[model samples]
Target: MSRDGTSASRNAPLVGTLLVLGYCVINSTKSVFEGSLVQHLSPEFIAFNSFVLAQGFYFMICRDKAALLATVRRCLPDVIALNVATMVSWVAVLYAFTVFEPAMANSVILGLVPSITIALGFKLRPGVRALRLEVVAALGMLAAMSFLVAAAWNGSSAIGDLPKDDLAAGLIYCVLTSFALSAITYFTRRLGDQGMSVQQMMASRFGVLILVTLGLLIGRDSFDAYTPRNIGAILLISIVGVIVSLYLLQAGMVRTEPITVSMLFGTNLIITYVVQFLDPRLHQSTTTFVGVLVLSAAMCLGAWARWRDGRDNPPAGVPDKVPAEVPAEAEGTTQNVGNRT
Candidate 1:
């Protein structure tokens, strides 16, 4: 790692953009499936089935068992924490969906991810400090998120309004989801520091979630409620959302700062709104339009931060300690985690 405590690859900006875009798309699609599937299935069942299926997919493609074993051994605590955090985030989000509007839930919870990730990164790796420009960018991003949520509440009633009965539970679950996701981001970076590949992390995480699911299923009648449609939805979500989305996330986080990665995920709100706008049946109010403008300005600030990083070699005052040329995959002996498939 550099003196700045970042393991960022040379192509971090390019790779991170692609990874975030792909993740946003997958998450948007997953919301669709969850909307349909959650009606007939319990959150535990959906989570369990998705992880089990995703683990199976990983097993079918995973190679370098010895290296994987070593990585797991070296990072057992991080791995366990990652798994626990991941499950909690998903379960909370699933339940939040039941009690709140999709936009409302994401607006409240997802904004916390980037801020919490920055705090966690600083705590875990003492040398990691946000550049002044990056701090400004992060605050802009948060402001944009607040604008979007306020828009949801004030305008486009269909996009943001929630029932009074479910408000307390929804807020609680959203808070849980946010904190858990932040923890997941921290552990992901820790695991990356231990030289674990994306595939290895995915395999270990889903494998652990599966085990937890089985433990929850003990003496329960949960499996009896499965239907072919819901089962198909689970398979789709497992493949696209769990397997593909997380793989991109793990791969990207290895080459990017965890806080930056989480910040990039904030784009999911824009993506979700865009998806809704494309649907002919829905109509957004004037407030949504103004919110989009504010969010776009936030994105411009974020883009400026990335541009500043790329153009200013020494980052204004910091000494040039990072290697001029480092192999992107030098973190571990098992180089290409994505190669097996």
Candidate 2:
């Protein structure tokens, strides 16, 4: 790659790492408080309210209409696709949680995100290639997630005990959720590369999300489920989970490789696993502890691959920074040469 390409590539991963950490931190904190709220309201109701508040906040923070319009004009298809992915993923995950255990459903579905993102990037992303090591790292992440789920699995509970209808429906929803998340990771990087800010991408994304949620609320008659307490909780979830998390994700997407984002995003559950250990009701078995260690190792491997790739493939057009003293030195030399002349 040329200098500019090399520089961009190098910078992208660093940006991605910071943003992923931001996403993880903010979302993990929000999640700690989310369980109680979920019990009081339907997923759709909570989702709708959260986006409505988030969208409103986005408008307040993003005041430059001209730039926003230009971004929309330039990346309409991508923006729309991204919003659809967001909407679909949220709805699918919420529905899946209704039919399956939260840990089991999330583990199975989210584990697919890294692989799907890699596959999609290979097929759809021009000029972007997946390295063998990257692929292996992604698979490792999936394996680690599976192990986490296994650790949480109750030996007494069997798949046969789940109603066949609910199981099939949950599986379908889970698949959709995984594919939608894959799309989000891919498109987020695409838009970020196109020079859109996290705020701009988030504002547009939430704008669409609000509309989608509204339609769902009206169509499903879920308004009756919302209470004053749930309303407050949903607002909180929106500000932290929807707004902050999505912004960090977009910011990170702009800087990092998509696969890195996918792999790291899958690890968000690590926070939940840690929180579980604090609760007497949520016991951590020897298997769960082992799974946590494996998950940590997988994340380390994926991060290393990303770092190596960035170093190896720098972006063109970015020149090395000139020494600040060079201009002054040249001016002094020019004066001396003039005196001699």
Candidate 3:
């Protein structure tokens, strides 16, 4: 383990870029699936797909049959929490879609993501402190929000403008979704401290979601018996969103700081909007534009914080566990969870 805060085996810059590209594709596909996939399958069935595909991929990567079950049992609780949060987030977003336009709802839902994550950070990891440059980063986030406000974004109008009751329902869904996703990020960071591979963490997380889905099927829905469309959506989600995109996230987070990773993911706001703009059928409005700018400012805040971290190390309160050199599989055996940084 190197004394530096990051893991010792710095994945090559080229490799990291490739990972980002991979995730971008996966995530973009996910954007499509989020709006479209639910029409074909039950949530329960989708969960099972995650389990099967993620598990299959994890095994293929590790190829260590002996340690797999033991590792899973060891981290079961954290994994389950992650899955719960994940399911909640998905449900919330889906509910939002039912009540709002995909573009508007997605913007607001994701626009609030970094702010929600900041709240989660304070709640979950009490010891960690925000860096001075984080203030600047925070300012950037605010700027981005301003852009969004100018855009005059409203989720309901595009979806036929729900009634007052439906609007209330939509708000609840968005909030729940945000809370769940925020917690998922916090828990994943904790799992990282455990030295688990991104693959392992994802496998365990998705694996539990599958179980939850199966449990839901006992009487909840007839999803245990999959139809062709259900099977296809689940398979696509597992393969693209969970297996491919998440590996990039895992590799990126291992190389990057947690907050930085959050910022990177937040960039999806830009990605989604740009995609919306290019789509002639997807009309943009005033409030939506305002929201984008405002959110852009917030993202800048996150970026500034990372830039500052590069100048000086992050506060030592958050212990650096995995040496940059040690592989995820080697966490328990080779690396002592000492502050290698």
Candidate 4:
């Protein structure tokens, strides 16, 4: 290789790491934005509008319309499953945000996603096994969640007092969010394994969700919620949260190791807490802060575990070049729309 080419190859991982970091920072703010939007616009309206905007964006940038249609047709069942899972997860998290403080909701609820995904993976894939460190990390994150729970129970939450019934309901919604997100992740990986590109998946994943949210808006008579300000907010979030962040993640994962991507994403908890701290409407209690720290650590540990496993079991040989038909799963990039929160 030429010297410049060699230099570029060496720097690719660094560039990818920076891109993923940018994604983490951008994605971390999603909950805060959605929380604010939900207070003015119904969750259904926000969801409906966001999905519509995102769908348009994806369609514009989609490179191979024919390939996307063919993939959807070939994997019609999986596409439907993915859409249902994304809808449930999206709506559940939005409802949870309405009940819990945005940052707190992110920490206490969305924080459980990795662990839940692990559990789901174990159950769904019989031959798969989790690393010891992953199990420990999952348990640690669960334990850390208790501190936030305790704060809420004692009426000492950082976001101010929440009603007990609402808190209970929010917890239930959180559970639903976690499970649905895990399912979405699982379906995303399965589709990737079956030859769907990330763009193809994103382009087709929201059909059911759009229909459901539209029905909800009609039933609630929420057309009035689409004021100029609300519309602007939806557009901004769709551009920043859905389109830009996913693009960065996809580009970064293509060049970086999966472990590095995982580790960078783990920092999202801290970034989210910091964003919440800056927002005048939200506050972080000491216990909740500590819990966030622990959860972040747990996430890092889990990433390390996965990395170690891969290292210990390297592929038998490196290919000179990737096969043309290899899917995104083989390339170490998978769609994860759940981060849009």
**Best candidate (score: TM-score):** 4
Q: TM-score of predicted model 2?
A: 0.72
Candidate 4 or 2, higher lDDT: 4
Candidate 1 residue pairs that clash: none
Clash-forming residue pairs, model 4: none
lDDT of 3 by residue, 125-167 (tens): 7675555555444545445534533333344132433466876
For model 4, residues 82-184, the per-residue Cα lDDT tens digits are 8998898888889887887765676666467757766677676545676778778778878887778888878766667888899998898888877777777
Query: For model 1, what is the C-alpha lDDT against the true structure?
Result: 0.60
Q: In candidate 3, how many Å is residue 226 off? A: 5.4
Which residue runs of candidate 4 sit more than 4 Å off their true CA positions? 317-341
Q: Could you tell me the lDDT of residue 169 within candidate 3?
A: 78
Q: Which candidate achieves the best lDDT against the true structure?
A: 4
Tens-digit lDDT string for candidate 1 (248-280): 655555555433544465555556656655534
All models, RMSD in angstroms:
7.9, 12.7, 7.3, 2.9
TM per model? 0.72, 0.72, 0.71, 0.91
Candidate 2 residue lDDT tens string, 1-341: 89999998778678778877777766644544543344445677777777778777886788897999899889999999988888888777777766554444555565565577667765767466666675776687589666644443443122224566776787777789878877776676678767776667767885565687788788977774456766667776876677667666656655654446545654555665565444333334455545555655555565566656656875687544322212110110001100000
Of 2 and 3, the candidate ranking higher by TM-score = 2
TM-score of 3: 0.71
Q: Select the stronger candidate by lDDT from 3 and 4.
A: 4
